[model samples]
Target: MLAIINDDLAGAGRPESIFISWLLWQPRGVDLASEALKEVQKLARYEKVDPDIARLKALFASLAGSDRSMH
Candidate 1:
């Protein structure tokens, strides 16, 4: 998790790609990114922002550790 977050914050595109690769390799770790995406999207709207845009932004922020609260 930390590694992925770090990669994202570093603006490395590989983490996102690598995550999918990890899924292909392990095939069972629960690719939690999807759920994370949904939850963060909800948070965005709950915070009174546009849900779709906020969701994407938050997901990117998440991948990049731009969001400080994911931990």
Candidate 2:
């Protein structure tokens, strides 16, 4: 499933590619997910802001504070 999504993301544009990058990082663990979120936030500054980005940032922020392990 990840491989399939990665293949699709290869051709994706801008913010979609950035968001997909975070999706790919998610299952690895909280550390990676946090790192990916930071990268997303940083990259988002250079691109036109999207409402979905804010939503995703909020989602990631909540996940970061959760005690549940991703694995």
User: TM-score of every model?
Assistant: 0.28, 0.34
lDDT of each: 0.46, 0.47
Clashing pairs for predicted structure model 2, backbone only = none
Give me the displacement of residue 4 in model 2, in angstroms. 16
Per-residue lDDT of candidate 2, residues 25-67 (tens digit): 5664458556644644553453336564444445454445643
Model 2: lowest-lDDT 10 consecutive positions:
1-10
The alpha-carbon deviation from the true structure for residue 24 of candidate 1, after best TM-score superposition, in angstroms, is: 22
Tens digit per residue, CA lDDT, model 1, 5-52 = 334655444434534443455446655566455444545544334343
Q: Which candidate is the best by lDDT?
A: 2
